[model samples]
Target: MTTTLIFTQLTIREAQRRKILWVGLLMGLVFLALFAVGFHYIVAEMDKYASLEEALTITGVLLTAGLYAVDLLVILMAVLISVAAVSGEIESHTVDVLVTKPIHRWQIILGKWLGFAILLTLYILFLAGGLMLIVY
Candidate 1:
């Protein structure tokens, strides 16, 4: 219970402090714009194709590629965010204050990891949702 609370608080604080939200929003907008442009091009090309089946197949392939691209973006962001979490705090000496608390060192580390994990999970969900919106 204590660990969970600590993790939740840390995650909330990090989310409020970092540029993750803005970066995510911008990435999502860009992804949607790209998907739109890609879909338009695919549709045009499909019209040139001889068979309706071939057009649908090509469209499906393009959509799959877009979905994979979105997943890659999400994974990249997750790695970047997690990589920054502990190292950034330590570099800024923010961890020092937390270390002085009554909490154990291991608890602090675990809490931070859990916080980053939660953030990554949310980021993945957002990316997946955006991809679904674009594809469907």
Candidate 2:
């Protein structure tokens, strides 16, 4: 438990130190910023549809497009982060230090996994919150 928590925290910190987390965060912010600009244009375009049904149709189309774009980014981020995480330290031979630790191998693995999970969660939450801001 303690080992897991420590590992998880370390993993998150490592990602930040390595700038992977920053890249994801920066990407998400860029996405949201672009979305905001697009949303403004969507609102502007909606003005052309004064009828209730037409306005709704335009909004639905625009919103769906925005969602699709976000979906692709999220998926890309997830895949890239996971792949890098699994092989990152190992490829650099940093895992050797952890192997010397008294902790069980499983605990070490679990800790690292937990850490990446937290990173991904934070990334997703940030993007989701941004999306909510755009929607609401």
Candidate 3:
């Protein structure tokens, strides 16, 4: 368990060193900004012509669409991160060091997964929080 935790910490540090977190954050912020501007214009237009109930329904639908986009973004990030992680290490021969170590291979994989999961959770929270703020 301690070994797994060590690998987990290493994986997170590696991601930080690569600036994956910063890139994801920057992209998420840009997405939120665009969503906010578009949502504002949509609400303004709806207010001009939509009844209260209709406006509320449309807003709900728009919010759902925005969430769907966020979901897709999360999926894409996970794929990009996971798909490259092991292969990238192997390609650069970095995995050789871990392979020779006493650690079980599963530990490395699990640690990477956990690290990426943590990152993705934070990413979703940030994006969703910003979206909610924009809507409400």
Each prediction's Cα RMSD?
A: 2.5, 2.1, 1.5
Clash total of candidate 2? 0
Residue pairs with colliding backbones in model 2 are none
| Candidate 2 lDDT by residue in tens digits, 7-103 | 8888777767776557877888998998888888877777875677887777777667767777787777767666776577789888788788788
Cα shift from native, residue 68, model 2 (Å): 2.6
Task: Provide the overall lDDT of each model, using Cα atoms, as 2-decimal numbers.
Answer: 0.74, 0.76, 0.87
Candidate 1 lDDT, tens digit per residue, 1-136? Answer: 5965676677668765778756865887788787887787767777886498887777678778877887787777767667776788789998798878776777777777777677667766776676666656
- Worst lDDT 10-window in candidate 1: 3-12
lDDT of 3 at 89: 94
Per-residue alpha-carbon lDDT of model 3 for 18-62, expressed as tens digits? 766677778888899999999999999998999999999999998
The ten-residue window of minimal lDDT in model 3 covers: 16-25
Q: List the residue pairs that clash in candidate 3.
A: none
Q: After superposition, how far is residue 59 of candidate 1 from its true place, in Å?
A: 2.8
Using TM-score, rank the candidates from best to worst. 3, 2, 1
Q: How close is candidate 2 to the true structure, as a TM-score?
A: 0.82
- The candidate scoring highest on lDDT is 3
